[model samples]
Target: MSYIQQSFSVQFEYKVFFTEKIFDTANTDFANFLESRAEKGIRKKLLFIVDDGVTKHHDYLQDQITAYFENIDGFELIQDIIVVPGGEASKNDLQLFYWLVNTLDQHAIDRHSYVVGIGGGSVLDLVGYVAAVSHRGVKHIRIPTTVLSQNDSGVGVKNGINYHGKKNFLGTFAPPAAVFNDATFLATLDERDWRSGMVEAVKVALIKDAGFFDWMESHAGLLTQADPASLQYLIRRCAELHMAHIGGAGDPFESGSSRPLDFGHWSAHKLEQLTDFELRHGEAVSIGIALDSVYSWLTGMLDADSLDRIIKLLKELRLPLYHPLLEIEDDQSAIVAGLEEFREHLGGQLTISLLRAIGKGQEVHSIDLAILRKAVNMLRDKW
Candidate 1:
């Protein structure tokens, strides 16, 4: 056993900035960030990849971005801002992934140059993966435009695309250079988009902050109506909780099987695929939370009053509590098969996060199928 040992550690730090109209000429936040990263003699390039859905709503976005960067020194912005389709379908297209990679190559986007992804979670995921694999890793920035992306996925280090109809089947743990969360984009989101996006907040509050959960419960009406103040607070709180878990939990890359942040995500992932992605990620997670909450009560892990409060809050927010596909038909049912897949994704035991109280979450290595079935039926029949 005569060999040199390998030992090294890399520190990753990035800021998630909250702003309105990030591309506005008067907004110096984006410009200031670029200025700070500029090298003395190097004129780094920036390639902007946008979501087509965003362009449709904000038609002046391209011109706005170009003009904003015009006066910024030490950086050259690529004029041809590429726009691609958004939503989960974007992650399912391998050709789209390669196309973007080829675009990066043609434009000579090197490691020093930055790839800025501006869109929802799915588009950001694709762009991040592309940047991560390109030149072994390129500097990438995120301008998340939706509630889901801004509060959860946009602030995290995971970047991935769906492979063979599986959610995030292929991906990497590449942190971005920085993330700019622009709240203006939330204004154009459809009711479903904004409504389903809040599930992440509910999830994080359930697992970590009972006080936050109580706040949400009190503001359920205002949140359901998408009141600006309530919505902003929800997004900020959720992002903070998510960031704290990622940085302070000692497992930013998820080297272990315990994923408390993924309390309701196991079935949520499968439900998204099972419904052909008709259900929004948040919507599916809403149902997953409901089912798991009921299951927790059935298993005696959570009190009945806590379960009632959870169910009531979800209902008041208008998030779904059940989907037909979630019904356990048999041992080989599609939803049931998801357990094994989820276990494989974790690379160890079948760990699932269940609530012990409003703000307390505990991880279990195994689940009782019979009780799980009962939980599903209870949700379907009662709620």
Candidate 2:
């Protein structure tokens, strides 16, 4: 047998910028952001994909994008602004992906050209996938509009859509060329959208930063009132924590099974599917967080005060602590099925992250089924 040993390394760098009214031509930020990647005097072509929900809020957004790029020296905007369904609906349909690739191919969107996604996390995920797979990879920029996207998912290096009723069943590890969090876009969100995204802030704080959790506890009332200053800080701090974990954890790609960032995601993902995605991602995570906190208490891994604090914060934020689907069981499938699927997704022994304390997470290889069931019942009874 003949053997050839080979190895190589490549470095990737991108920036997450915070701004407002990015498409306003007077704002030099978007122009400069685009120009940074351009060759001397060369115009970079861009295809803009937006979420319909965003367009509904900012009716002039499509026009603004075209006008802004027209005035910019180093960028050209494609006339078409493709608007897709918002939320999980965007990721659930694979046909949308094929259409995006076809559009890119038709327009000759090469590796050097850009595909920009402006929307919530799901839209960004779908668009990122399309960009990554086109001509190996086109430079992709993410303008994450929602609190969840701005804070967590949009800033990360992962992109995916659900498949076979599984969360992120198909995806990639392609980071965006840049990320822009426009605080202005968040202003018009309905109550559900506004409140749902903040749970991610809670999730990250519970597992990684007790200080952050304490801060959230104190500002819960302000946050509930949709105080812009408080919400902006919430997004920035959560993004900072998430970025630190991705940069420092050395497992950005989930190359190992221990997904510490996904502390309560096993049941969260399953709950979303069981509800047929009627539940928003953050809403599901809120319930999952409550469930895991209770489980941790049942196992004596976390103290009661911390658990109470967690539940109290969730309630204050208007997030639900329990869902009926969570306790449902069928002959062939149950919410517990998520555990096995999650284990298989990570590809090795099961690793479930539980709270050891408010700011600390502990990973376990096995869970006591009876205790978990009891915890669910406890949550059901209380709610």
Candidate 3:
């Protein structure tokens, strides 16, 4: 071999700012961030791609963004802030992806310019992917508007879209330049979105923070009612845990099969697709958590008492623990196929995160089908 050694390291750092009404001129967080990134002589362009759902609720959003950026010193906001349909449907539309990319091309959104995605996780995922592939990677900013996005997907480095009905089948690991989580946007979410959004916090607590889980147990009523303080705490704590796992765990890009953060996501991803995305991501994960928790108990990893508490908390949170499609009819069943699909996604072994205790997660390479069937039966009948 005549090749010489090649080695280098890249450092990635971004802040997740918690704010309310980010575009309000009184709130300088958004402007301050832009000013910090401003170059001496270059007028950086900012292109905002918003979620339609957000615009529908915050009717003054477009005007607010325009007026807010007018005072920014070194940045020029794209006059036409594009609005696209939100939710999983956005990710599944290949035409939508290309349309956004074409829009970027038409606007000449180079790498120097920034693409801001303001919406839920799905919209952000699509926007991030568009930014990543456009001009070989443009700087992108995230203003996550929902609990699910703010606390989980938006803070992370991964950006993806669905392909052929598979969840995140096509995606990239492109870190955002910054993430701004505006708590104000969460207030407009409908009841289902509000309730289902808290499941990630519950999921993270079950696998990593027993104390957090206890707190949720005590404040289940407040959380269920969407108490502002309680929900804020949940979002902050969940985001912190997810960020810690991403940065501190030494696997920000997930190079291995051991994904402890995905404690209950194996079946969750499948359930979302199987339900044609009728089930919210968090709702699917709630059911997945219940299934895996029951499976853990059946396999003698988690105690019965711990299992009870987990199920009780999920119920108190008003999240679903069962879905019709979750049934495992046989080896050919759709949901069961998720196991292999998940393994394929991970790419080496069939690593699944199962609970061993309230705050502890253990990864296993194999699962017994019969036991899983029993667990499913128990959830459908016993719960």
- lDDT string for model 1 (1-383, tens) is 79999999999999999899998999999999998998999989999999998999999999998899889999999999999999999999999999999999999999999999999999999999999999999999999988899999999999999998878989999999999988899999999999999999999999999999999999999999999889999999999999999999999999998899999988999999999999999999999999889999999999999999999999998999999999997778888888888999878889999999999999999988999999999998996
Give TM-scores for every candidate, taking all chains together and pairing residue i with residue i. 0.99, 0.97, 0.99
Candidates 1 and 3 compared: the better one by lDDT is: 1
Q: What's the distance in Å from true for residue 381, model 3?
A: 0.5
Cα misplacement distance, residue 199 of candidate 1 (Å): 0.2
Residue-level error in angstroms, candidate 3, position 193: 0.5
Q: Which ten residues in a row have the lowest lDDT in candidate 1?
A: 329-338
Per-residue lDDT for 139-246 in model 2, tens only? 899999998899999999999888877888898999899999999999988889889999989989988999999999999999999999999999999999999998
Cα lDDT tens digits for candidate 3, 1-383: 69989999899999999999999999999899988898998888999999999999998999999999889888889999999999999999999999999999999999999999999999999999999999999999999999999999999999999999888889999999999999999999998998898898988898899999999999999998899999999999999999999999988889987799898899999999999999999999999999999999999999999999999999999999999898988878898899999999879989999999998889999999999999999989998
Clashing pairs in model 1? none
Clashing pairs in 2: none
Q: Give the least accurate 10-residue stretch of model 2, judged by summed lDDT.
A: 325-334
Query: Best lDDT goes to which candidate?
Result: 1
Rate residue 174 of model 3 by lDDT.
92
